[model samples]
Target: MSIDFLKKYFFGDVQSSSDVSSVAFQQSALRILLALTLCIFLVSEVHFLFTAGDYSFLAINSVYLAALIGLLYLSRRYEKATAILFLFTLVTASILLLTLSNEFHAEKYALISLYSLPLITRLLFTFKASIVAMVANLYPFYLITNNSWMGSAEFLDSANLLTSADALAGASIAPSFYFQMLTFVTLNIGLPLAVSRIIQTLESHAIKMKDLNQKLNSHYAMYEEFFENTGTPSLLCDQRGKVLKANQLCRHLLTGGIKKSLAHSNITDWLTPAGENSRFAWQSDMAECTLKSDSQTHINIRRASLTEHGHLVIHLENTTELKAIQQELESTQETNSRLAHFDVLTRLPNHRHFCQQVNQRLAEHDKHVTGAMFIIRISQFKLLNKQYGKDNANKVILSFAKTLTHKLSDQAVVGRLRGVKFSCFIPLSQTYLIQKNLSELIKSILPKQITVEGNKLNMEYQVGIAYYHTDGKNAEALLERCEMALEYSNSVERFSFYNNNLENKLIEEHTLGLSLSSAIKNKHITIWLQPQVNASGDICSFEALARWQHNGQYIPPPQFISIAENLGLLPLLAENLVRALVETLTDWQKEHIHTPIAFNLAGQELMNDGFFAFLMALVTDKPWLKDRLELEITETSPVMTHPLVHKRLRSLSQYGYSIAIDDFGTGQASLGQLVDIPANILKIDRRFVFPLPHDQRHVDIVKSTIQLAKSLDMKVIAEGIETKEQATLLIAMGCNTLQGYYYGKPSPMTDWTSHSNAKAKTLRMVY
Candidate 1:
């Protein structure tokens, strides 16, 4: 190690100094290079001093140069070595300076500045290494100064020994070199340290700005996505009311792929013309507008201005669906209103609306001359619908309206007030002409068959003309008198004008109709019993005939029945009859009247889905009632019009209720239907009885009907039996049950049961 160090330090050619410290090496190298350069400049200037033979300065300079070259070589190796090698280099440098007293004294005063290298080591290396370097640099100064080796003559003379006398004698370094050194310390060391801190601060700010830019981009991307995918159209505008951005929906609505950056188009164009003064204008600061487009679809536009971004956001929402829903709701409300005030099928004002219109007309009654009004009704409309169908019946009504329209003037108005019924208004000037025209028109129109669903319908219209005030201007009273006139027309088979005498007749009819409820409740609607004798002339059952009596006048069942069904009072009549028969049977059952009681079922009652169950429940818990209770439904009942009746009747039969088909030969039932129904008994119609015992066509039909019933396992009974001759003829022809005045005139339960005629007595007339 010493040999290499001597060669490296003395010869300035160290090749294997491996363990040198980087800071120590750099510090020593810098000092040595600075010393050598100064010596070179001094030697060049003082060649004459060398001629005077003062060679000590030359020797000292050579030593310093050698030390500097060794320091440079050590510095190269020391930067790669550990702190210990740097410490050794520091100690070795200190020892070398100690041996050369003159060279040490020349640099010994610089030891204080060199001590700062140890402070650099503490900043750049470990504390122990710094302390070692600090002591190594400072101890030489302490030794040279305290031991009196640092005096001016000896110390400066040692540094001067390497310089020629001629270089020192006349040449000068000038005072600026020291000043330049001071300026170099300030510019290089101080400025570079300050610059490094500034660069670090700028780099940290760059990193923060980069992170903030990333967050802003992320938020902007999210906002773009939300606006584009939302259902409503969205637009963003700048402060000048120019569109800056628009979402996909807004593009489709307003620009049609034109970029939102367009200047001319904006939210103002989307506003309805009617809403030009709307708040969509920036000056108005209004944010919303609702209007209809050219396509009649409704749209709602909403806007919000952003003061910070200096832009406005517009949202367009189509409200067409909401408007459609509102229209549908309004239509439903209108239908309910119509139902409350008008008839459903006719589309004409109902009784309710008619009364209101009449009252209104009465309020303005003094404004015009009195006019005559006509309440016209087609008397056979129900029978027509029953024979044909409702489709034909509706055509008949429409035909009547057409005829009345053609006959009356434009000033006159006709309205359908009830089913198969119409009312007409006319001025008194043309009353006679209107009445004559209406009469002739009805005569011409009523006879023609109306074709409906490929079926011909025959019907007749009955007109009841009532002059205003004379027939009572009040709606109810006038309607009553008009009905009386219609009743007269139907009886006479012609148009009937209301006269003073018809009021009494109308009073009588009203009295009869009003007493009907009481009569039904009291069982005064007589259950006239008629015996049905079997083929062997044995009584099998008795049919109950409903007869009405008002003020001692007997009214037929057919006359009251049609009215009862129309008034919605058929159910009450049915309930009363069922109760009366059940009450009568309670006594008869005690007397051992173990016979089936057959009653005629109304067409209206059979059509009702609830009527059968109601009757069944009324007879519930009376199991004895089942065998004797027979439901006689006519073939003319509107069963074919509503097919569900058969299913409902089949359900009743499944529960052990017996149902019978009455008037089989005269009705509209087809031959195919006669076999498929659930009835247990088939009654020969009264029309068959009308041509019986003589008419071959009637006999053939009756024979076929009987065969048809027998094939279906249904018992056949002949109705309208009058004479013993007809009975004997029917019995001989295998007709089983007979009912008419021949067995007994339709008598009440008490009279029929108590009379001697209740027995199987022979008839007065012989067969």
Candidate 2:
């Protein structure tokens, strides 16, 4: 047996004496047999010792050795080898008991052989062996007790004498019998009890082993389950790196079948060529790869080394969505860039991008034939803008750009340079063929009316062509020449080319904007008051006009008005004019002037809420002239933005203050708006007034406007009447009210008061 099995079997504290005793017992039994055999041999030799020749059969001792060999073999192979060994010892002890009793006439000392039975059983077997040992010891003792030696012992003890040899032998036998009883008690009772305790300990060990095995089996089952069901392509492998178990996910990931082994498949074979050498020895790295399958997918391959199992895990994260997101972001960025460089309303290249394009095109002019930049500007667009709001103005600009785009082909680069100013680049080779057609196309597109918010607006555009290498080459020079031509176009009736005279016009406008502030402060501005006549042929109000007295010359109102508006001096100028009017009207009222005096308000002034309050504060300070003071709002002023101004105007009107709509027909005013506006007087625009004498359309509009004003309890006044014929035509067209050069031109307060007093005498005579 192995040393481990031997160690388990010999778990006791035994001495060498006990071992030698066991060997002596075995030799004694063999010696007893030998003695029996010798006795038989002597009997055979002597031939006259005893008469039972059949006793020769009992002398053969080979059966004992044969049984010994058989028991030894059984002990080696039997599952309960301990019990079998104990049985063999018990049989040997029983044989000794029976042979000694029979041969020695049931001697009480024969029971001593049973003493070895308990030792043999307890050493080799468990509690079951102890029971067998008890049977062996007790059965022999019973037989010996019932033998004639026991009866003889009893009779000898009863006689209580040592006279006969039988009695003495019986007495000896009685002591021997008592000794056997003691040995039987020690072996059968005490040894069986000790063996039973040892068997309990062995049973405890067996229970503990069973519990340990159960725990091991449970843990094994749990690990088995985990390896089978783990969803992230799991693999359980042996120490040799051979796959022990593969989960469903792992099978699907690797080859879609569990029959094929993962051990022979190289991980690199499943990945794209880009990921062949991408493995990191220590940890992980991102690798973009395409799967080797029908699916066209990009994945980020990640690997983790599992050193415990000598395995590696590969996770493929599809990055197709991330790439799509990146692509969409790039597209959005490009679109935003395009919007920045191009006009949102017109969809044309804006000023900054146009300049860059021009520079790029010019840089490639080494072998070019020629190129020209035409700065196409809308002429008198400010008139359209003043008539309509910016919303309509934007629509007009869009329409103009579209027209320009249609006129020009791929060769031409067009851009919205600025407000109402567009640039067109034309190759010189095609400029000639396109020049006339381009001008005609611009005119055709411009004159057409554009409807915005149901307001049809007539607008116009002017083109100014400045050729490179002929007119100018550089961006600044070319733009300057084109702008000059645009200015020249404004002076003439139609589109015009840039000539040397264009500089003089720019110098004039520049000089005007620079000198205007000084001119207002230095009394260089002449004030003219236009009379407002009621239906009774009497002066109702007078509109104060600003005429620039420039170096002993007169600058027309249009020239200085545009300059003041552009330079942002219009508000200051308007304030000064209002203050001047208050002073002028205050003095006139002192002189018994009963006519109302009005100061013109610009659209820019109307945008300032404080401006109307300032005017009201001025009037409040001068209470005596309040009744004679009137405020004039031009139709061009953005009335929609000034709701408070309208309310204040209405309050002023309730206090007997008069309001007038100056340059009436020149702006966007409907009959509906006029009915609601706080106005007591309407001034017919000069254009309509000038054409009233000849044009029936002008006369009809004038008649309708006059009648409408009278119906609204407002007096209508016709302006710019430089001739009696125009005045007579206005008077005959049911428009008796008039204010122009024919009545008396706009003059200084001194000249105005003088002319007005003289005209009062004439009106008194006519009445």
Please tell me which predicted candidate would have the highest lDDT against the true structure: 2
Q: Which digits, one per residue and each the tens of the lDDT, describe model 1 over residues 440-520?
A: 644653445555667665555677877666667766676767777877775566688788888786666567677776676
For model 1, give the RMSD to the true fold.
Answer: 15.3
Cα error, residue 248 of model 1, in Å, equals: 4.0
Question: Candidate 2 at residue 537, lDDT?
Answer: 50
Tell me how many clashing residue pairs each candidate has: 17, 0
C-alpha positional error of residue 480 in candidate 2 after TM-score superposition, expressed in Å: 5.2
Residues 41-99, model 2: lDDT tens digits: 45544553355554443343334434444544443345254345435544654566455
lDDT comparing candidate 2 with the true structure: 0.64
Looking at candidate 2, the ten consecutive residues that score lowest on lDDT are 11-20
Question: Which candidate wins on TM-score?
Answer: 2
Cα lDDT, all candidates:
0.63, 0.64
- lDDT, candidate 2, residue 157? 49
Q: After best superposition, candidate 1 residue 435: deviation in angstroms?
A: 9.7
Off by over 4 Å in 2: 1-353, 366-368, 375-411, 414-423, 430-464, 479-503, 521-523, 530-542, 636-648, 686-701, 720-737, 752-767
